[model samples]
Target: MTIATTGEADALPEILTERRGAVQWVIFNRPKARNAITPWMEDRLIEICREVDADPAVKALVLTGAAGDKPAFMAGADLSCLQSVKTPEDYTILEDRAETAAMALEAVRVPTIAALAGACVGEGALLAACCDVRIATPSVRFGFPIARTVGNCLSIKNLARLAAILGTARTKEMIFSARLLTADDLAGAGALRGVVPDDDLTERTQELAEELAGLAPLTLWTTREALRRWRDHGLPADGDADLLRLCYLSADYQEGIAAFLEKRRPVWVGQ
Candidate 1:
């Protein structure tokens, strides 16, 4: 199936949701910004996740970046959205919305696949990690390069998620080095279900979705939940809510965001 498009000019919705047979596609549609996530996008995605999760007709989901002049899976949070965040309250609100969306996606109770390519970073990486499976092109670059760019911290929940996928030492190296790993590297580490040619990405993702859609929905969902429960067992009871507030309210994080928007290097004062 051709990747679905809307409008004559292909004007994209923030969250482009399409139901194809028993598979649901929740596409991130801000390709110009590398599908960088916005707050509204977060809310729309959560709504879509809940909608599909509740639908008995839907058995699987495929999430990807919308086709654009420059195709990208997802780069992270939109810098413009980051610009508006000033206080701890502002940051908390943003994190809460993201957390809500992430939790909703995790709770979908269906097989979920992330069709990732190009650049997937920061929050985008976290989103992909939340999915049950990931597929990407060999050239894809992804990681939480916050140390070099945003200077913001991932909530312990997200850190744990990545750690579970990539292991503790590799996770440390990924963050501390502030480098994006090639798709091959991540795949070799068992982070991706498979790696395909760049041109075959969409088709491969669709094929996998269809295959998953044929499975017993109840069995698939229960297995996903079982793995999630085991993963959650490692998390601290209180969660990492406070960590988000701490980093979001920091002067270094503010400087990082401002510098990124200004297209300059961030001068970290380490507040």
Candidate 2:
């Protein structure tokens, strides 16, 4: 459907963008590929998150996959993109970008929600874990096939974040065996708020988002900040803080901010 305000469809084929009251709704646009995160899609995702962060009108955010009349959030990072990173350094750069995007989602001032419907696998699972709330559909499944498929290590930061959010035992089972968690199992394990039928998932998610939007803005923002800081505060003596500082100060950050305020799509010059 066309978005009357923007003169565009509410959702794009790659990523649907819309505003529902005080909530910024970003739906993954590629259901054909199970909503995999392509490199370009990753860039667009970060830009959208940055825009939401700067918008005072947005009180909450929702991330889900674009599945018509169904629930399927995202599959994971695009396997196609991984083919280019042959060397260790190349892989590290790719991970850095993904990590930056994940951190950006956490840094948003408003509460974020992720609706997991079908295949929330690999990097997609990690992204969902970072959100403040997660809702799943009956057919939803979660797993990271990285150990078996990618042969890449999950960063210590991601490991800690997942373990803290999902707890030690569940986290170990998730990462070690790379087993997929069914929606019912996740709900029982406290990973998701509840499991809805696929058809009702969007309605339920919107209901929760709207509920959050009605709250005192500062109250929610500060609460989110506190939770994030509490978890990120003890990050070990890695140069992550310094690196992240540099990223915020970089020319890309400035371009991103300017483009967002101008309400035009950013032309990211990956500096």
Candidate 3:
């Protein structure tokens, strides 16, 4: 269902939300762009998380991309948007919003599930990791491909989130190799709760959401909160800022952006 949100009236909303029984479904709606996130979408997502948290009636939250022949839970952040962020100040602002959005999703009071398909890379992968459970189709391609496509780095918080699910070794290997992890890869790592056929994704997700919705809410919330605190116990207030600057401020980053837009290989040189 189309949600009436504050945005340009002429343009389609990048994010759409629907209520299915006690479950709230949040769909990333920009199918033409493979649902790559823009700053505005991130803001909307944060708002949705807040709304869900405030509503006691909402028992579960499910996030997914719009249906299409080539679906993407989210390809990543929009490159066109990232291209505009050239300075450290701009990058900081961008990361701040993204981190806020991710944290918001992680802190949702209801059980969260990611109904993933196709590309779920970079920021998309990180956000999916924030979900309490993930169910994907065979078409799922998950990982951080920044090393090959963007030449940018993830913040320490994002790394920790991934590491928590995929383990530190696989996480490091994922970034270093720049290879997209398939459904089997994620399922084997215990990151994906289940992998179903592409056609059954929606039905399966709804069934799982309904089951979770029937459980004791306080128990679910407590378990989620406990794990979150355990994962975040030692995280510093300032996390990998220098590393973010090193990559976002580098010449190779600019080259990567240009090459990606131009459909060419990025010639990366450590700056």
TM-score of each: 0.93, 0.80, 0.95
- Worst-scoring 10-residue span by lDDT in model 3: 1-10
Tens digits of per-residue lDDT, candidate 1, 168-239, equal 898999999999989877987899989999789978888999999888878888888888888888678557
Clashes of 2: 1
Q: Model-by-model lDDT, in order?
A: 0.83, 0.74, 0.89
* TM-score of candidate 2 against the unseen true structure: 0.80
**Clashing residue pairs in candidate 3, if any?**
none
User: Model 2, stretches more than 4 Å misplaced?
Assistant: 1-12, 68-71, 237-271
Residue-pair clashes, model 1:
0
Query: What is the alpha-carbon lDDT of model 2 when measured against the actual structure?
Result: 0.74
